[model samples]
Target: MLPPELPPLPALTRAEGELIDRYLEVLDLLGRINPARNSGTYTGLRAAQALVTKAAALRDALTVMHNRGESELHGETLARALRVLDGERRAGLVTVPPPADN
Candidate 1:
C-alpha cells in the first residue's frame, strides 16, 4: 500500500527558513550531547564542541531577521514548519527518556 501523504511545509521568509534550519542543527547537536542518551564521553564531547558553533549560527539567523525588521515570531506558522520538518522527533531525542520497565 502507498504511504500516507505528508502535509506541505508552511511558507516562510528567507530569514525564518534559516532560523529553523539553524535551530534544528543546534537541537541535533544537543541530542547527541545528551548524557542520558549517550554512553561515550568522546561522542558527547564532540557534539558539545560543535554545539558552540551551531548555537552561533542560530544566533546569526535571529540577528539577521531582527536587522531585517522581522521583530515578531509567528509561533503558529513556525510550529507548523517545525512539525513538517520532523521537529517533534528531533526534539524528543534531546529529552530524558522515560524510565525503563524492569
Candidate 2:
C-alpha cells in the first residue's frame, strides 16, 4: 500500500531541500551496486560502500545539527561531503554530481 501524503515541511529551506535531494541521488547510485553480493571483485565495491556510508554519516550528522538548532554548520559539512563525492564522480566512480548550483 502507498503511504499517505502529508503537508509540506516548513523548516526546510531551499538549500536544505536541495541537500536532501542530493542525498536521495547518492542513495540511488549506491543502491544500483550490489556491494554484498559482488564477490568476484570486492575492492571497488568495498570502496563504494565506504563512500556511501560516509556520505550517509554526514547526512545523519546534519540532521542532528539541524535538530539542535545548529543548522548553520550543515551547509559547510554537507558541501565537504558532496565535494568528496564530486571528486569520485569526476574520476568516473559514480554518476551523481555534487551540489553544483549551491
lDDT of 2 by residue, 1-102 (tens): 987654334355555655655565655445444343234456556657776765776577567657867646455555555444442343243344345685
Q: Which window of ten consecutive residues has the lowest lDDT sum in model 2?
A: 87-96
C-alpha positional error of residue 95 in candidate 1 after TM-score superposition, expressed in Å: 1.0
- Write the residue-wise lDDT of candidate 1 on 1-102 in tens digits: 998888998999999999999999999999999999998999999999999999999999999999998899999999999999989999999999999999
Model 2 residue runs over 4 Å out of place are 1-3, 37-102
Best by lDDT: 1
Clashing pairs in 1: none
In candidate 2, how many Å is residue 76 off? 18
Clashing pairs in 2: none
